[model samples]
Target: MRHLYIHVPFCARRCSYCDFAIAVRKRVPAARYVETIRREHALRREREPGWDTPLDTLYLGGGTPSLLPPGDLADLVTTFALNSDAEVTLEANPDDVTLDAAAAWSSCGVTRVSLGVQSFHAAVLEWMHRTHDVAAAERAVETLRAAGIGEVSLDLIFALPAGMEHDFRRDLERAIRLAPDHLAVYGLSVEPRTPLARWVARGRTVLGDDEQFAHEFLLAHEILTEAGFDHYEVSNYARRLPQGGSRRARHNWAYWNDAAYAGLGPSAHGFAEGIRRWNVREWVAYERAVARGNDPIEGKERLTPAQRALERVYLGLRTVAGIPAADLANPSSSRSFLAATDAGWLTTRAGRVYATPSGWLMLDALAAALTTSPEGG
Candidate 1:
């Protein structure tokens, strides 16, 4: 199924760990950006001539998508042809969520809201340079659900700075109590050129080690599973309803499952057929490219069969859905998969394989091992 992703690169303030392409704007340039997105889409439509297929899922991800007024948000998403029952999602900052904004988004046809709470603890929020406090996070959840949003997804960062891990359980427990439809817990990482990295370089901040990360990651998985949440992806948990059904993040699942998707805006990535492309990283460059009526995509690579095979393994390993065993029937790949299972890094059930918790911890190494092609097919 075709998916549409609109990237909004505006944020209130740059987070310490954010290395994504973003511009902190005092006033969102919503109208101009939306126009650019449409222009670029037209160019792509001309280039392909067969992109009129309606999108199955539309995701508005960002710097902070909620920064857009609901009317503009609607204007942005309506640029595409979406399926009748498409899953439309918007990512919002916890501090920005209110009854009015949530209600506006719901009326705009957003099926899901992914709140960027970061952490429910004030200290942790402060360390992460998040604007929202514990109370605001709680209120965001309450107000959002009351606003009639069908799905509420909480974004939490675990394996925090030195002292925060001690109270991490409290944050997890509080999130569970909120009863969100989905939870995405990410283990913190210090990316290069970010404030957190500079702090570590200056010996001002000491990040957690692997064991610390493992502890908190396992804690979240265990607690959420006991609460009846499905560990559908390595870092995502989808809550099971009382009716015994679940709704996965359709947009992201498309990525993991290697489906073709189109992305708009700066630094957004898209893939169709075997080609993977991304727009320019800077706002200025992307604007200039789009203004010229040419593709803002600065780079693209066509994947070979082996490369796609490796990607399938890598993406599959990062989720509950493992790659087909037949995909690794080659001698080297089969040996690697067998070795991974022997070391308790993977498990097989029915016709599929799943990553164990330990496997998730060493996921990269495991995927590489499982995709090691011997010469050619």
Candidate 2:
């Protein structure tokens, strides 16, 4: 396996905009979850005997992975076979980060920490209901650095409510000043029936319009690129390593490259051998299923060839690596592809095709423009 992802689903409280499968309880079920994860790992290893699968990345993502004590995270790492220099990453809320916590993580082999800062602005943070204030978030970054965590990535949300009165440039500037090894700045989306969605539905909140969206998106591209960060993927940026390269999130890169990976724990998803699978979101049900020697997977599908091809085009366009020129320039989609080049939305260099910043803003259309029917017409 190229990567192993463990989903830690316990959170102190649900964020307003979150729709991830998580269990919010005052008393977290950390011990039970850790033991269950160990059992799941053993079961998985026994069923596959694939310990020989050399994993280069291990990502502990979640509702809140930093909620666990360092010991549990360490045990989880030992349970799997990992590369000597595997990039082990854990997602942490700002409030959970501390000098001691970071030291513990470093001691236990965690090489990266992704902090959920959301925003440095107080009102925006309030709207998101994040526990950590701007001061706390800033301190969290400093503390992680002081404890010697090699990489720290901050998460920021833009496109706030209409009257939120915050500047996107300010947020980007603050992020640059922090000099985090990585940054994930995403536009706020009100997913289905979450609290934010409900508020929007009731006309109690206003999501930014298209013009504001374009302004902020383009502004970030300019600012971040100027700051020497590589815009590696649509929403991700990586700092230039001292040795003259990017410290990109390898696990996430694996996903974009369509590499095989294992996903463990409730609500986790995995893609392997052309198959996509996911476990049940409910922890109790997932545990019972695993305990009874049943596969925790609630659903799975073998992607068709066409589906795979479509995913390749879509995902590739989302990154700086556009789909291969040869694959996309078939007779059928030639006109659309040529039109993009004519309009200065796409560019080709050396051998690979890449989307210009403007083209990236219209990724869905740009990717679709390269798709041809199975008959090659």
Model 1, range 1-377, lDDT digits (tens) per residue? 38888889999899889998998999988888888888888888888754688888999998899999887888887777888898999999988898888999998789999999878777778877887888999999999989999999999888877865457788889999999999999998989999999998998988888888999999998999998898888999999878886768989999999998888899999898899999898887898889987778889999998789889888997888887666666533466676778888888877677888889999887777766645212
Q: List the residue pairs that clash in candidate 2.
A: none
What's the lDDT for all of these models? 0.85, 0.85
Worst 10 residues of 2 by lDDT: 368-377
Clashing pairs in 1: none
Candidate 1 backbone clash number: 0
- Residue-wise lDDT of candidate 2 within 1-377, one digit each (tens)? 77889999888888999999888878877778888988887788888856468789999999899999777777776777778898999999989987888898988888999999988899888888888899998999999999999999999888787999988899999999999999998888889878999999999998889778778878888999899899988889999776888978999998988888889999999888899999999878888988888889889999998778778887887787676767664632577777778888788876677888778778887776577533231
Cα displacement (angstroms), candidate 1, residue 110, comes to 0.5
My TM-score estimates for the predictions, one after another, are 0.95, 0.96
- Candidate 1 residue 160 C-alpha distance from true site, Å: 1.4
> lDDT (0-100) at residue 160 of candidate 2?
81
